[model samples]
Target: MRSVYVFPGQGSQHKGMGAGLFEKFPELVAQADDVLGYSVEELCLRDPDRVLSQTRYTQPALYVVNSLTYLDRTTERGELPAAVAGHSLGEYCALFAAGAFDFATGLRLVAKRGELMSRAPKGAMAAVVNLDEERVREILTGLPFRNVDIANINARTQCILSGEYDELHDPRLRAAYTEAGARFVPLNVSAAFHSRCMTDVQQEFALHLAGFDLAELTLPVVANYTARPYPTKGYADHLAHQISGSVRWYESMSWLIAQGHRDFQEIGPGNVLTKLTAQILKDPLPVETAPAPQPAPAAVRARPRTELVFMYGGQGTQYHQMGRGLYDTDPVFRDAMDRCDAAHRATAGTSLLAAVHDDTRRGRPFDDILTSHAALYSIGYSLTEMLRAAGIHPDAVLGHSLGEYVAATAAGALSFEDGLRLVTRQARLLQERCPDGGMLSVLDSPDLYRSRRDLFGDIALAAVNYDRNFVVSGAGTRLAALQQALDAEGVITVRLPVRHAFHSALLDPIRPDFLALTRDVTVTTPRLPVHSSMLAGRLGTRHGWDEYLWDVIRRPVRFDELMASEFTAPGRHFFVDLSASGSFANFLKHGYAPALRGAPAINQFGNNSGTVRALRDELRRLAGV
Candidate 1:
């Protein structure tokens, strides 16, 4: 009575696959939407044919639906399998089911893998039936082209060849396979799967996987490349390399059979893997022999509890008139600001307090008050230090966009002086790279800009804040074109006051220089947990300050993902806004309503000592220390 769960790979996708599942399970839909930052239902059901078939959409969509199906099946009955395994793309689903990586990490990895795979040379795949594995390999070995190879060895008499289209069409190779008594059927696939053509992508994806923590599989999960159980260590690396390696499906099934596993359940869209398993088994049993399902965890009941505190702030939230009243009312805050101003002027060559308040440059705009790199850095330092002096400590810290440096300083990864210095230098370098172009905040979906490519063809949606809100930036003409297009659609677009296209591809030129500046800076690990907007998740031990700060400029700011992951933890409460104003706080309230569940009591400490004191009292009361 031994049983195992198996997952399917790329070609298992079809239109209208997960529509019914989303309808039946609304919570699963919401979870998938939050993780993907899009409408899961729209992607699964309503896509206009080819859109769903794209590599990026297809891989993630399949993974989501497959994982959800597994959940649903297991929840319906109370039976857990003794082991798990999957084909190429399905290997991630296996690891996720085994708890090696969480759902979000798995989704992100699959998405990135799909993106990299799409960039490979356009190729195709073919299924060779009624052929021995050794004979197919021998025939492929004599091929004239260097691109072709045996991709998936599904059964003893079946294998799939993946390579370039031209190589697949080679008369000599096709004739050799035909002569070897095999039936060849070409598959409708883009890019050669499980071939050396994917080597370049495999290398990069390995580095990405290094950032994740890979634990041993709790269940006996077979590997597609080695056709054996996963090793406790280096499973992530193994999975990455499996991309370009041959999928030993026959050998994997043999190993499972050796382990006394008879019944197999393929819990995903399509029965591709199940059919393959049947073909491989010596005596194919009825599909009814599949393992019984398992019951799900009890539904999480909504409870009103508040304990965790998330502090938010960053550089851009500073203003010239900020802390004017605080300086008069609170001596501690005034002294902290004074110290910050002196240190900042020494390193960044600017008076931060003057920039935030009483900027006497006539005819200058209000945004220009703290627009300088030095001014923003100094204000962030001063504000964070003021909070610390007022005795408020957060359980976790998240910074939005430029606020990461402030969060680093708060976490003790970067000293206040060093954080200010780095921020000032980084800001000045970015400003120098693009002096005129600015960013525009558009209150519309990024898909709108992507869909209507002709209207704002030149403009790039730099930041995807949420599904319906984004920040578009480029040259003035391009920005104007995009704004006009949105206006025509009855969407209001607001121009950001900053004078740089912050996250656009235009900043690519400046990244190398910025990386050079960060090379010599000392970056220590943070005392508290810090989530990165660049990586769209919590920072792992591998991501030190040096790597995080340098790449922050080049990578897209994934603040929306951060909010979704951080606030979803149970009993989490009190997001403390550490910036000069409540800009980020407002974003959280509106963008993350589902995660926060109706605003879990915000504490806006906008450069004021009274607000800081109240937050400190709340923390002390909650902690009871």
Candidate 2:
């Protein structure tokens, strides 16, 4: 179970949002006033002049209140969520939590963003409900409404449109909406947002973003334009494009849900996002209303008989100083690290642990494809041992891509030494032979890309992670060209963090070498159930161990199908991600059936001691210990 903190955007503001928070964080409030050249406390607490309704005043006021609200909550709770997201104006709040910049810097930028938007020509914006994106686009594309563009995708069936004020006021357009059985309500905003109407404003905002320096976010912040978590770099470019891009609220929420975040807390004033989230996720009970005859509060459901499944993550998942806390706090983990270090030194003549445990705490050039694989194998295998020592046993095991080695070792199908040997050989061959390429997580169905293969020259569909999410791998230039084309068509894509384009034709040359490395190691029958992601089925007596090892390099990973099979089985299941960062839990949660929505899926070492404590508390509650 993971928690996501969401912040509301501009339309959620009210006359008295920061009433209590203003006095609680006076220093922050003062700083906000000094930065914006106005009294944020007065605008939020009283709004005596009624000027807070204006876009310029509204953005700064809401930013201050939202920031104060977050500070107040975290101060009292003494913990941070696993990730953060924000609506249009609220994205600044999310970035603040990521530590991309300071409070003053965020306030300064928000003020400018608001000021520029306020200066745009007056335009009309309206919400269209009970209609999907395709239908809305069809309506706006035909006849005199061609200039209208979608401003916000609030939910699967809800969207907002922005266009010239005069064109939107036509009675015929309103009649067309009524005839289509869609409810249309005009918004009070004076300027059109997230549309071509703000092109000039967007250009100016880009200049503002350039002047400020933004550090990489500590926690992932889902972007409104991309509907994916922000990448390791390029914060400035994303924010610049976001000025005139549609606010992908529903998609962003769904992405978070797919990552296994079941608990979401609305951080700012007003329950707009809270109510909207309930609508998007389809919570049966209305979140905004309380009826007089409301039923009793839902009881905490008792845990059913549960089974645990261990999933290992593969390459490109490692980062600087990963497992730092495990090496310090857990002696078992440290001992395993020492053993891996010795093995690595024996083979490579240098200790890989020093690079994995880089004291600089910053990314360097040496954190490349070769070292990343070594660290992943060492840290992942050691963490599994620690879990076994703690009496946490797995009923089954599987791995994604490079994680198969750890999975095989944990399932007793192979020895740790042999697994390390295979990993080392694979890494060396890949580093020495494979050409440079990239992988992009295309946020659409495989059919979407497969149907238009001609458009994606040289790019191959590597893996289908979910119904609408797939990965495309190919040479760097071709992949970049594909990404640009997708962006132009309003399709979201994320560049995966990996050195080589894997699960594609580029790895074919290294297959024979990898097979030779595997032949030297002895194979045995599994002591526990071991699932094969490549086969998208259980590794029954049908396939030989050597065959799966060869297929690991030659075949693509069918993670989507593998999850569907696991989640649909007879008993309650828990997917535990044994990776350095524990980020794979989100993908497991994403593929889970709706019936298993609240199951206890755990991610080891996400926050070191915090994750350990959460796993303990959940297991005890389930066992009734």
Cα-based lDDT for every prediction: 0.67, 0.74
Q: Can you give the TM-score per candidate against the true fold?
A: 0.52, 0.50
- Most accurate candidate by TM-score: 1
Task: Score candidate 1 by TM-score against the native.
Answer: 0.52
lDDT of 1 by residue, 1-625 (tens): 7468998888888888876677767776777678777876787777854677778788888888888777777777676678888888888888888888777778888888888888888888888988877578646643434457678878878889988777887777778888888888888888888875676677677767768777656776778765667764545545765777678788788667765677989978899888878876784222222221211111222433353444444433444566566677767667877877887778667777766677474224345422455555545555556656656555566666677777777777777777766776776776677545666777777667656767766565556666667776778767777777778889988876566666556766676777777776776656776767655555543233555675565445666645543344333465666555656656766676545522212222344556555556766666564
**What are the clashing pairs of model 2?**
259-586
Residue 227 error, candidate 2, Å: 44
Best by lDDT: 2
CA-RMSD of model 1 = 16.2
Query: Where's the lowest-lDDT run of ten residues in candidate 1?
Result: 292-301
